[model samples]
Target: MSSPVRYAYYSIAASVLTLGLKFGAWTLTGSVGLLSDATESLVNLAAGMLALWALLVAVQPADDGHAYGHGKAEYFSSGAEGVLIIVAAGGIVWAAVGRFLDPQPLDRLGLGLVMALAASAVNWFTARGMLRAARRYDSITLEADARHLMTDVWTSAGLVAGLAVLLVAPPSWAVLDPIIAVVMAANIVVTGVGLVRRSLGGLMDKALPEDEMRAIHEAIRAVAGQGALYHGLRTRKSGPRRFVDFHLLVPGATSVARAHTLCDAVELSIVSRLPGTLVTIHVEPEEEPASFDGHAVGGACAGGGDCGSCPGAAD
Candidate 1:
């Protein structure tokens, strides 16, 4: 439905097409390196389909069972992709070790390299576009997809270079094919671990980055430019959405209508600046108990959904 989602669909198409091309190349040349590259493309096909499904679910409106919406589904998809990467790497290692034990001569050298490079070129362009879309939408699904494609591009490039060397290489150097495959696997292991780490952080509801957090603070200050007091500032990101909430301390003489108006203004400012952000403002009298002021303690501690140990935190 959205631009980012459209890109996801395109990714699926690219994965299917490339997988076919790479496998055909591997079959023709019998190059273990090309086989390794093609194997990774298969994983890409599966991951792309999963990402599409996750993005669809993530865009659904909040329902009774999911008050916060289904945005976290994207993290699950990302984590799955990470696991898939590791699995693919293991498969590559196993294949490489086998090939290393019994080196085999390759055929159709020139043709295979051409096919592989063509697939890589498609991925190169697709990955570049996906990276741009990911940043624009702040969608982890697209980011993971982009990272996967970029890794594929590099792996394909390495395989082509290694195969090209075999064209003039002595017969004794055939082992290099499998060894290079092992190296490619090692390189992808790092990518898998990084994706898994990012997915877990999202699942844990990581706080916004320092820059965006600063923006949230600035928006609050600008909307309450008259010096209204606030505390209990907190923020978290869920998929493409941001959540922020805080306490608004107003003078006791201020009428309810005026307090409501101020809260409305602050929420509008933040939503406008952050985009897709949800803000909650809890209004209270300036003279409220000390617990109110200490509740959040510099706006860092989560307060454990209670007053917490902060002396000024509300009960």
Candidate 2:
């Protein structure tokens, strides 16, 4: 399996183990906060499994049906994970409200809190590793999985705090447990919204960031040199790949083969500067002095009294 698939698989396994442990602790302690944390873990487990599947599907080679490949599967997986997080938050709110209605007497608060803390620590490490892998590989699925794990860590920490407060504080503070659970649920909902936004952007083929576009422009100019002009730059992301397409204007007299060579050279230069990027260049012959500056025109030629076919000819 690819690195992304391996990372996602391990993440899914860790989430499953975490869910089971947190649920068991909740059963023993009857802590509403722990229940909320467990619910989030359940969502994490489901999301991780789906992420693994998405990683697998995303790595598939481009087929006749999908010329751009199956990378967008990651976006669907991410959106699904976001929806699951929202659902988990709703469940958490319901559990917290139920606990407020009929508060359960929590037991072994210290032990349960310790267990939750341990689970949180595990998640912290797992999330860090997954995030590192995602950055190195530029894998969207792994990044989403990492975000889910980080959410688990935060929710687990919140649960630990709520339980600790409930144990030491006066009876009047018992409500803090449910209150913290609500807060944790709200936090999850906020994170879910962000994930959904990113997924939607990916699905919608949002343009590349301005900085990236500028970088491409610089790279093209560097390869084409001073005389050439470019426009109609566009870009999009597909899983780990960046698709960049742009138009380049060259002198009319430049041979087609040489222009093709120059285009290849520009692409190579850009690709060298950019990692995990695919570029397509469309060459357009310089028609007239559409936007040329004086320096672009080298000198007068024999035919038209001007090197109109030369760089900056109209200029």
Candidate 3:
């Protein structure tokens, strides 16, 4: 698989290209809407730089001080990008408000529209590639960057369409320039907030998605065999890596070698189902009353009763 840093570099390159194109458009036409588009491309440039740094940090191997690895560094990159996006939106709104109070005639709008369209085309292709890489690598940082680029593309498209309307309408319709800028700002704010929320969730060590959890359960249950049970299943993800820990219950008469073999099998099954997963299994004899003590995810089952009542039974 290609490293995320490669894709991050792709984003940075695209941002630089689009940023120049957009600023050129803004300069040519003196349109607030075009200025708003340029502002977002500036944010994209900063965000891409941050993503590159974060991806470099996140790839570092686990050290003595950080046993879990530096994967959570990715969350910081995405969160910081989100903040930059919102700040850029605020700047756009401020510019739009100024233009609203004192409207100005747009100059050379036809050439400006052409430049904006070219920038949007570059962003559209770059975002698509980044999005595909994100899905393949399960990298949140890449996904955030790609989404922001796509937002910029849409914003540019909207501004182009609105400016086109102004070109044909009366000079009185010049107010649409600021109005379109405000609308574009609102559209990007939504994307910014979404990225912020997702980044926060990742930093908080949120559980894996439902489908991944279901796959884990299926893997465990397949290796558990008849009469054996499991409990206290817990899961979390850090960047592209998933972590799972659980308790496996079996008859007291099961030999130590057999238990070790079963634990190995269960771990293999889970790792197969979800690549890049780290699994820890605690083996406990089912006859032990203390084994059923629920501490994390699964419910406790009192000793000498049917294990079917345990929360893990359903899983």
Q: How close to the true structure is residue 202 of candidate 3, measured as C-alpha lDDT?
A: 90
- Full-model lDDT, candidate 2: 0.81
lDDT of each: 0.86, 0.81, 0.87
Model 2: how far is 102 from its true place, Å? Answer: 2.8
lDDT of 3 by residue, 1-315 (tens): 248899999999999999999999999999999999999999999999999998998888899998999989899999999999999989999999999999999999999999999999999999999999999988999999999999888888888998999788888899999999999989988999998998998998777777887787778777875445676666788888999887788889999999999899989999999999999988888888777644434422222133456644444
Give the best candidate by TM-score: 3
RMSD of each: 3.2, 7.0, 3.7
Candidate 2 wrongly placed segments (more than 4 Å): 288-315
CA deviation > 4 Å runs, candidate 1: 225-228, 291-315
RMSD of 1: 3.2
- Writing each residue's lDDT as its tens digit, candidate 1 over 186-259 gives 98889999999999998987778878877777788788874646667778888899999888777888898998
Please give the lDDT score for candidate 3: 0.87
Task: Report the candidate with higher TM-score, 1 versus 2.
Answer: 1
Per-model TM-score on C-alpha atoms: 0.90, 0.89, 0.92
